[model samples]
Target: MPVIAVLALDGVPGHELTGPGMCFGTAARHHPHVAYELRYCTAPGFRGTGSPAPFRIDTPWGLEGLADADTVLLPGHAGFRDEPEPEVADALRAAADRGSRIGAFGTGTFTLAATGLLDRCRAATGRQYAAELARRHPRVEVDPEGAVVDADPFHSAAGVLGGLDLCLHLITLDHGVPVAIETERQVFMQLHAPAGAEDATGPAIRHGTGPHSLGPTIRWMEAHLDHPLTLNDIADHAGLTVRGLNRRFRAETGLSPLQYLLRARVQAAQRLLERGDEPVERIATRTGLGTPANLRHHFQHHTGTGPRIYRTAFRSMVAALTWADGKHAEPAEPDGPAGADTDPGPSGSADDRRAARRRT
Candidate 1:
């Protein structure tokens, strides 16, 4: 089994620590063949207590624990904005030199950025912090819209639940899709399943004072997914000019208003596909994608899979996992429907599609 070193710095968020442990631990229990030996390591001279509460973390591992790790995960800490300790940077650099995969969870990307490993590489942090990350580290290409970014040896995940996505991605790479999908279903209850996993929930709505908060506008957009909404309509509803809305949306959500609306439509389609047996043309009209061909094009472009295949594959997996006999079984292979290509298209990885959207 590969040894995974999870480094928890002072003021580490309690959830990030337990989240990965739960994910990897559940995978081990459910599929022993894909097991990983997980160890919690701390920075040198670090206090055992963490911020946001008064709880102590006692771990037997230290910086030295990363020496032989097959992978090292850095979760967010309260002081992530501050430059990492020189010793921590040196140890991380040394670990990278040893060919261990280094991943930054949420704001921990700051610490990885400090080590210069992520410089010139693409990284995804929380959308709220994407602008700041780009500003702070001009050399690192910050992907604001990506749920998770896999730049080979350097990986990063966006937002609070993004760590779960990163863990699933790692599992997908190590084992395969079936194990990762089962691990997600058994572990996280499918709450934050990797990007392609369909759900009713869309991207989080930002809440704040002044122009930054797009809660009302986002809700309006969601409510009007079936209607053809233009940029001016959205900007008018938000009481902002087109340029201002675009700028603010980019700053707050890391996506332009239209891009956000496009994602909302696609996500709405996902929910419909997952819940019903509607025809592709009817679903397209309902989601305002206009036509079936357009829906197929955009859905494939954004999600890396067509609607028919996604629905088939997702339902098959759900059925496989929900066996009545209380026995685990491999997911059923999705029989590709006519006109629905099983190929994910030329967009490459999900990360690449997200990057393409970011560029747009």
Candidate 2:
């Protein structure tokens, strides 16, 4: 059996934190050879404990509990911005360094990235934080697409409840499509099952076959976009004998790794500009794109509009999406029932699509 140690940090989104435990718990019962043994480590002062009694209780595990696990799962939480008192990062990084497969859900992706374990690795997080994560870290590659990403042993899901997608894929990959179909039929929720799986809930993935198949060096390059990285640096990090990572990167993101990084920088600059908190040069440096002139060039090329205008326009849209006469932001859709791509995250539909079109 493959053992999984879940670092049940506090403030993990209620469902995201517990969902993996439940999914893997079910797997343990449903399959003998590929069961997951889960243990939750208790940290006395973590954000996830604020939930009501049932959610914020004691666990049987401790930091040392992660030692023997084959995979370590980190659930997302908003509280990760603040450093933890315990040697939390050490435990997570240690497990990751040992080649244990790693998984993250919701904001948990942020924590994983923070350990620098995910440096030069392609990672994904909730849709809300994709731009922010990229800007702040400047190194990690975050896919905004809803599909789960598996690079080597690291599997990540985007957005809330995205873990369901990641978890289902894991079962299908290990147990075969028929077993996945059996499980899906028994379960009552809609899942984004990639193609080739007999019981997939969505379109199949036509590339890479699986996550672990991605190039190891490419993974490292995506993880370290923050530092002054060159193609040589990336190749060296991935332990690839050649000095060029461009071809593989082009294959992965439809652009060379540097091109992808620049594009990502532009996007990050745009997001921060919208927040109305920084100047263009600062935003450029922060995004790793460099210069007001350079930002203007790409910003104009990408959106057919200049940076100043984009930021002004985005700020206006933000105001309209949240406040009507200066009110607090409300749910994008409060009355909508559970469904596919329900909440696209704090934004306006008509304006957003229009803006997104402009970017494309």
lDDT of 1 by residue, 21-65 (tens): 888877776543456899999997677545344378888899999
Q: Pick the candidate with the highest TM-score.
A: 1
Worst 10 residues of 2 by lDDT: 200-209
Per-residue accuracy of model 2 over 247-345 as CA lDDT, tens digit each:
555565466666665655665565566544688888777766667898899888765678888767655644453223112211222333344233344
Clashing pairs in 1: none
Give Cα-based local distance difference scores for all models: 0.72, 0.58
Q: Native-vs-model 1 lDDT?
A: 0.72
Worst 10 residues of 1 by lDDT: 324-333
Instruction: Give the true-structure RMSD of model 1.
Output: 21.0
Q: TM-scores of all models? A: 0.55, 0.50
